[model samples]
Target: MRKLWLPLLVVVMVWMVAGNGEARLRPDFYGSACSNVEGIVRQAVRRKLNQTVVTIPATLRLFFHDCFVQGCDASVMIASARDDAEKDASDNLSLAGDGFDTVIKAKQAVEAQCPGVVSCADILAIAARDVVVLSGGPNFTVELGRRDGLISRAALVAGRLPGPDFDLDRLVSLFRLNNLTARDMIALSGAHTVGFSHCSRFASRLYSFNSTTAVDPSLNAAYARALMRACPRDVDPTIAVNMDLYTPITFDNVYYKNLLDGEGLFTSDEVLFTDRRSRPTVERFASDQAAFFRAFSAAMVRLGRLGVKTGGQGEIRRDCTALNS
Candidate 1:
């Protein structure tokens, strides 16, 4: 009886923490309070994205990182005085500054039109979609009424965000916890089509991935040579290279095509093609850009709903970087 009780108790705790009891989300959630919310966010995101092209992928990734850990509540944006908040987590350290800046700026813009009428959580969801559209990806509608989470813990990030080297099975297992499927995982990976990765994330593949000889045999020779030059043995860890070299600034199927040619920047990206269960999805996306866009847009909507807050579950934070005071 004791053994059975322990397992059941653990399951219940996990369910509760995952926000299984939160209010449902809807597209017209702010219809009465802020009818112009989406327009406000779209304008703000575009303005900031124009300042730096990197903002497109950064904002998209920011939404993923936030949704995975504790739902799309903007908990990732919370600041910790002790430096032990989600931002302190190593997995989150690579998140570009422009991503956070875009959210902050959007929040400020929304406030100007309808003070205290929008939640950072909803702003993040809408902004993420806008960034994807600006990058030439499909435009999808996001459900709103998400309230901001009050807790932000660094400890939760490690197990939440899939590592840069996660294999197919591992990626599937992690995303499943958030109601994401294998197809969703591959489609969402398409976001890599517009981002940049720091050398440190893939330096191992360029220099002694497994042995001391330097370079992974799975990588294409020409791509490896280029990577070596871009990321030298003693190069600064902060130095970055575009994830999609073929069309570095566009949101397209070239990323999957690169995988077919062995140009994937991270082991995690390459494995999608190597793993049988995921290979078909990768191939389909590579051969058809429209299909990839459709899948990606649908996946984004599903991801945006993970463990979301609605009604009075959370708050409408005045400052996006801090919880309500």
Candidate 2:
């Protein structure tokens, strides 16, 4: 009995020491430590970005629409209030254009307070959350420490970002290119639960057999009439617009429910339910708001990591609207 006890004790000691050595090999394993300057900078930047979003919800949505279309580049931020034609040409409305201005103002404030401490990418991320909140969605804290992009290529905008014409496959492919999974694709599209779109974007669905732009027949008749009124046939092709009339200011499972009922306004919105691969995720999100929020938050964290060049890889942009020119 004594000999057996000694061997067991020796084995326990070996196991304990080996476990400590393995833990040391892990890169993220650490003991309690003081938060660094980078941590403080991250917090400040997030706070400012969140505030900017609350102040300008429409702008945040526009910013997101522009960025997602083109590699998260900030070119869509460029606008001149005096030139309505120029603004419209770029698809920039007064509400969205002002939001861009607010982002710039917030960026300037952060520079004044932190001086090259926060990144444009981080600002965009936090601002997106604020947009969700203002639109009547859940507000969650975003992890920061992203650095600004030194370059903002306009050419990248047209081909990279998803548009009103894209189908489920195209949408999924774009998200995949950005490192987003199928789950992320469904969760992020839930954002549409709270915004509006131009009729020009979805008119093809109503008028043509183009599956990518076709409207669902199950939409509410009154809602359809309102959209048609706002976008009559004689209306200029560029002037037609449509709002996500239901839950336009709230973030919930209604978007998914709309899809379930064949009421999705955009083909992209409807494809989630139509596509074989994406259908399950859509149903899950539609059935559970809390689940949707959880997945959405996780996906956002992943999205914020896309193309992020941190530490020595990128510069902190003083102006979020323009490249470091």
Candidate 3:
């Protein structure tokens, strides 16, 4: 009986150790191949965004327009000229035009290297990072494993995405609806560090605007001047859009930095620095790029999961330029 007991103890210890070993190896076993493909896709998207003549800030705008409207379906990134008339009529300037071409080139290159494995969703994420880097922002790794969303709903564009005028509470709610936390909302809004906005979208804040909403007093002078120059007070209602004056192409803490300095270009953007609840997160991101990157990656992972109808739930349109016929 003593001999049998000793043998059982040894067998149990060996089994436990082996189980631990397999557990440790599981992530690598499951993730290594996908990681490599994701890396390749990231590099490919980066290369294309860098090489393209379109300004980095403009590209970032296109990316946001595409993703926020649909579930990063790459539909907004497609051109409709080859598709039917309904598709052509539905074409969005931000998506179906030059940006779509750029994504297509990148997607084609990635497909050649990795075949059917790499997802369009992953490509969009990589491309966005590339755009930020080109615009003069820090580079961060985006986690892979997002599958391409097949259906792109144009109508979802207006309500789903937050606009420039959204106050802190409204913005927080929008982010929450998408499964994002307050921290995520602040960090993700850091993307504004690189892009531009039309003055028309923000003119209300400068001219006769909401007084209850705090405007950065430090920014009032420069903001008013820039607005005057861009709008001319009485001429055309159209406002020529300009990229974020500083670090328009870079993805850095400069956005938060701008807010701290009262240089934020939009009312919604400046409010992050002033809001009591959100200010600390904004300052943290401003001071620590590493911290910002970590949070941003996490937030992006969450954002990618929002309203995503994956697998058979959606169809992969062969032509991203138009919805499925």
Best model number under TM-score: 1
Q: Rank the candidates by lDDT, best first.
A: 1, 3, 2
**RMSD to the hidden true structure, all candidates:** 10.8, 17.1, 17.1
Q: Please give each candidate's TM-score.
A: 0.92, 0.71, 0.73
Model 1 worst lDDT run, 10 consecutive residues: 7-16
Residue 317 lDDT in model 3? 44
lDDT digits (tens) for residues 188-251 of candidate 2: 8777775455556666656564566444464444444555566656566445232344544466
Give me candidate 2's TM-score against the actual structure: 0.71
**Cα-lDDT of candidate 3:** 0.55
Comparing 1 and 2 by TM-score, which wins? Answer: 1
Task: Tell me, by lDDT, which candidate is best.
Answer: 1
Candidate 2: Cα lDDT at 218: 44
| TM-score attained by model 3 | 0.73
Looking at model 3, which ten-residue stretch has the lowest summed lDDT?
Answer: 9-18
- The window of 10 residues in a row where model 2 has the poorest summed lDDT is 9-18
lDDT of each: 0.82, 0.55, 0.55
Please state the error at residue 121 of candidate 3 in Å.
Answer: 2.4
Better of 1 and 3 by TM-score: 1
